[model samples]
Target: MKFYNRETELEALSKMRDLSFKEHSQMTVLTGRRRIGKTSLILESCKGTDTVYLFVNRGNEAALCKSFAETIVREFDIFVPEETSFARLFTFLMELGERKKYNLIIDEFQEFFYINKVVYSQIQDIWDRYRKKTNVNLIISGSVYTLMNRIFKEYKEPLYGRADSLMKLSPFSTNVIKDILKDYKSDYSNDDLLALYTFTGGVPKYIELFMNQGATDIETMVDFMIRSESPFLSEGNILLIQEFGRKYGNYFSILTAIANGKNTIPEIEEALGDTSVTGHLKRLEEDYELIKKKRPIFAKEGTQTVRYEISDMFLRFWFRYFIKYNDLIESQNLPLLADIIKKDYPTYSGLTLEMYFRQKMMESHEFRNIGSWWEGKKSTEQNEIDIVGIYADDKRALVGEVKRQRKNFKPELFNAKVEAIRKKALFKYEIETKCLTLDDM
Candidate 1:
């Protein structure tokens, strides 16, 4: 695939490449979910440069040693003994870097924990010994969240503060989807793009799969994406398993419960099994990077009215449609799913639009900060503000709700919601109010 926009990251990589020749080793740690094109980004940036890519696996120490030796010998055409260990192989690369400038990439780096628990310390030793004498740019990439952070970000880790650059590769933006549609000569309308964005959230791999058939209508998309035997059908299960292992079953239950409209802690626990969900929720938020705890809009720091929501657009969509109807989908009844989708889609999608707004708020420069708002009452008296953006410099804030159906924008609904927001806003910063929509903004 010809690479799309990563101009900022590319520039950052180039700067790191230039800096690699300085006294210290120039290292970058790239982290993201699986198949968000982290490797693609690395490949594109390393083009025409002397670069070596090594993919680490979760095998035993001896197997990993052999793989490293083979990778070094095969990629560099260097003669080496069969029984060489990774320590020796990496040490040799460090010496080579003393003579020539090169880029070294270790993909799926988190597997090193399983392969050799001491590998990070060993690398740190080599780096400290030879960093000033070498001109190598090292990039460590991983899909596992906790392991990667422990190796590089944790204060006590051997490689702590070692990275000169850290890039967390995220899903592509909605604009990228529009660009893809335009490039493919698909004349999809704005609403179609919004629906696609709601479902895929700019994940390049998922978008490309659904875009293959040259149809962009939401109804057609639901048919193609949720149908039996579709590659995307059970993708959520695979994705979560890859990230969280067997514990993914619990996480899946939590996400599915949220998708079914269970938001509070007690509600989620009841829906999943019991209060044991507390541990699973913590891991989902802290380790897997899949969910977030949401407090009411204007709540103070440490305010207690909190709810949980899935943080990824594609996962939310998957749980809402595919996982919720797992039985029907598995029994080869896609038309039945299509029917359920037809009935529930508007409601489900209206929820997704709120997420869409969050993505836009993250990327937009118009707002200084953005978040959601709700009342202090956890279950009872809960009024929601879908999108809340603050413009402190302007003494103004933008409060808006997102709906899938096309209808006239109403100010009365805004007034009712604003009162609830005002009650919560008292504890935090304040600003004037404005309403917005997809077109209005």
Candidate 2:
């Protein structure tokens, strides 16, 4: 598929390149989760330019330096002495930048932690010595969020405060996905569109995989992704293990519980056999950003009522089926796994539809705040509202429930819940109630 969005990011990167030449060497740090296209964006920005690209793979430090030295020699077309470490190789590049201006892209930069822990300090020393004299636009990209944050965002780290620009890449928006779907299949229905969003979550790499195999429809996409050779089966396992480190077991258990609908603190802990998960959950939310903590709309700051949801759409779907049915996966029963997901998809997609409308509302930029409201202690099926939006000026509110079909909606019961929230919290504003289905998308 063609590059859909990121016009603004490309513009900013180009502007930063100009600024780097005007001032001195400018360091740019780009971070996002795995498969979010950080590397693709960087490479796209350097088309037809003098660029040296280095991938920091997990291996011997000296061997990696030799590889990078070869790349530098190939890109610059000059004879150079061999270097044994990144520190020496990088110092050579910085000195070379004094005369030749080029783009220096280092991808998977966090892997330096495994190759050589002192690489950060070495680069910091080299950068400080040559920054004012060098003219290179140095861009470093990483996928591991925690280690990357520690390397640049924390105060004590050597690279802290060194970046001229820091950008966290986000997923493609709803409209971008719709346009891409139309580009591939002009006759696509809202169900196919929702399935694409539900499965890929607008992440470029996953979407590319699906589209490459001609998996434009729901059944085809499910078949391609759930097979034995498919990458989706092990995606969550590999990526999160890299992020959470050695104590990944506990984190995985907590995440799996949340994905399976054990949302609340107590419920997750119980599902994990009473494992102590409070600290783990906090890290997952505030640090890893894999899960989001949600409270009811108009809820107080000190409210004890809280719920957790996996923030990544693809991972949410993966954990719900791929992790939950490890027995089927390990036995290579992929047909059964696909069947199970097909059986459960209707109920599952209904929940995803709620998120679709919530995202649609957010895209409009019309709401000051958007969330669902539920009663505190006496909460049950009757008191839950799937979506609530307070208008930007606080004059109107949008309250609604989400369902896959119109016949499944209960208008009278929903109005009763709307009245309850109106009297309890939103009494001051005019409210609009809606039942968002697939057609709304």
Candidate 3:
């Protein structure tokens, strides 16, 4: 439960703090998907400062105002009069902020805009009126991708030019998770660590589940996670719906289709029976931040040939195994679920190996850029390339494929990746080619 490793991010926070010590106020926007540990990073950053942590919820303006006032009162030891409204509540805080410097973190800030649309204007007014002398370091954090993006970056929004620094707290890299497990004396092997990355992709909360379940290996962890009543069993449902709203069911189906190898739009639509998924795909990529539209390596700017893939690892695994078997799980058909997991786990994990490879790439200093590349030339001519590592300069690149199976990467597998990369025009760039197994990586 204690913070383990966020040294680089903490250093960035320290820089922000130093900047806030100047005459002007400072604002940092921390954004990421749900459960990526934005709140934890901010709390760690505000360790010794005069910090007020206000979390906005799904409630009316008046309810949020009351909660804000109470938190401020408790945090700063401010005295409140008999009664107050939302405007008066913030006005008092503005006055106090002008007098003394403090760190204020507003978590789940998108909820405020939904509940009361004018809260941003009110804060902007107070900020414009009195921010010069406040010296307050404000960091607003949120998990809602579209709303939070609009709040900070949209030109028409009230807080458009307000941010001094932006930090998107991504999931921890595999090295960070390895450090945490080592610190906790968890003694898991490299393969076990890779397996964890396969399933969770370094989400701290999910890692903690395996830790708590005493799962020293992947099999036990899967057994613990796929149960009907486990916290993580239904976690993707809650997290995805929170980000994407009721439209999540459609997005989930699309993701499931993609994970199960229905890569093309037509293929995914036929598989899910959701002919309206074209519109759903647009929102899923642009708004919800769930899946990404990946073009081939040499795609032109106006290329319409692209593939949709789940952008998050846990969701990828969730849709692949858990969501597809939701009925059996809900009906408490444990034996059936277990049998499916046993039968298809390697197949599922062979796909998840891409995530584990990406994690390793992120941990390595050699690769400045890492992503996947594929070709969309043929209908049944499906070409797949797993991991692409671009070197530090624009001069060089490394094209590679990853397999999680125990067997060696045969000559055919390597040749297929090479052929696919050539079809993608990667050879035109003079890129190096490498075929990697889980062991080679």
Candidate 4:
């Protein structure tokens, strides 16, 4: 459960902090989804330095500022008015920056939108007025992806273009996951690795929870996740409700359909019994960033062979099992729900295995483009290639067939599929065929 694989991010933050000390004030914005370890990374970077960490909780602004002032007094041994507003506290901190250097970290910076929506404008004014003379390293972290994007990226927002640096933290990579497993269970099997990837998707919080409960294998992980009073049961809903709000019904339906294997627009519409989901789909992809629109590697942007997929592995699993079996969960049938997941986990993990290899190939940095290739529609299952990676040099490509069991991968049929796609390929390049199974992990 120890921190793993944030060396690059930590180095970047260190450079920014050093720059803040050498130059004037600098603003760094850290953004990621909930439980991706933003706060941990920030605290680790600010260790051994003078830091004032302010956690934004939903409450009256004046009361919140009073608590913040107490923290400043305890940490920095300086005093200001206890009843000062957030605006005044921020201004006072900036004035202090003019005299000395310190790191000012505001966790959950987006919560200010709920406490007092105008706080952004006020901070913007204070930052612009004092930036040239202050020597503070301002670090802000937000878990609400959509709100953080709007606050910094939108041109019309008050804090737009104010950040000197923006860092978006992603989940731990495949190698880091392997290291974690090796530390926890040195004799782990491929199934253990796949189950960890399938469930946690390298999210630090979830992995820590499983490791703390000694759930080192597939069955134990499923039991721990589905037991009564398990936090995993309600995690997805809690993560998305704030972003989707009152209109979550349609979004949930669309996501569940995709998770259940209806990826195309027509199939999803048919499954939902609705025709107008274009706007919702766009928002899900572009605004919320929960889903991604994927096309074949060489396909044009206007190609009709587009598919929608949940970008987060954890959410995909949650929608597939937890949301789909809500009735069983609500009826206090945790045993039944766990049994159902255990029954279908093989097939589910098979699909996730394909995703795992694709991600691994992406992290290798050997390919310029990576995606699945299908000759015909979804009905023609034989014409699909599990993975296709165009080499970064542009002269060679990798076509792979992925399966859960090594016995299920037929080299003859897979080679024939590769040849058929090669003939239809745009360029006359060399194709290397590969058979991937859990052994590759």
Better of 1 and 4 by TM-score: 4
Clash pairs detected, candidate 4: none
Clashing pairs in 3: none
Model 4 local distance difference test score: 0.92
lDDT of each: 0.77, 0.90, 0.76, 0.92
lDDT of 1 by residue, 259-295 (tens): 7778888888888667568788878888777889887
Please identify model 3 stretches exceeding 4 Å from their true place: 184-186, 274-276, 362-376, 379-385, 393-397, 416-433
Candidate 4 has its poorest 10 consecutive residues by lDDT at 374-383
Provide the clashing-pair count of each candidate structure.
2, 0, 0, 0
For lDDT, the strongest prediction is: 4
Q: In lDDT terms, how accurate is model 3?
A: 0.76
Worst 10 residues of 3 by lDDT: 374-383
- Cα-based TM-score, every candidate: 0.89, 0.98, 0.89, 0.98
**Using alpha carbons, what is the TM-score of model 2?**
0.98
TM-score of 4: 0.98
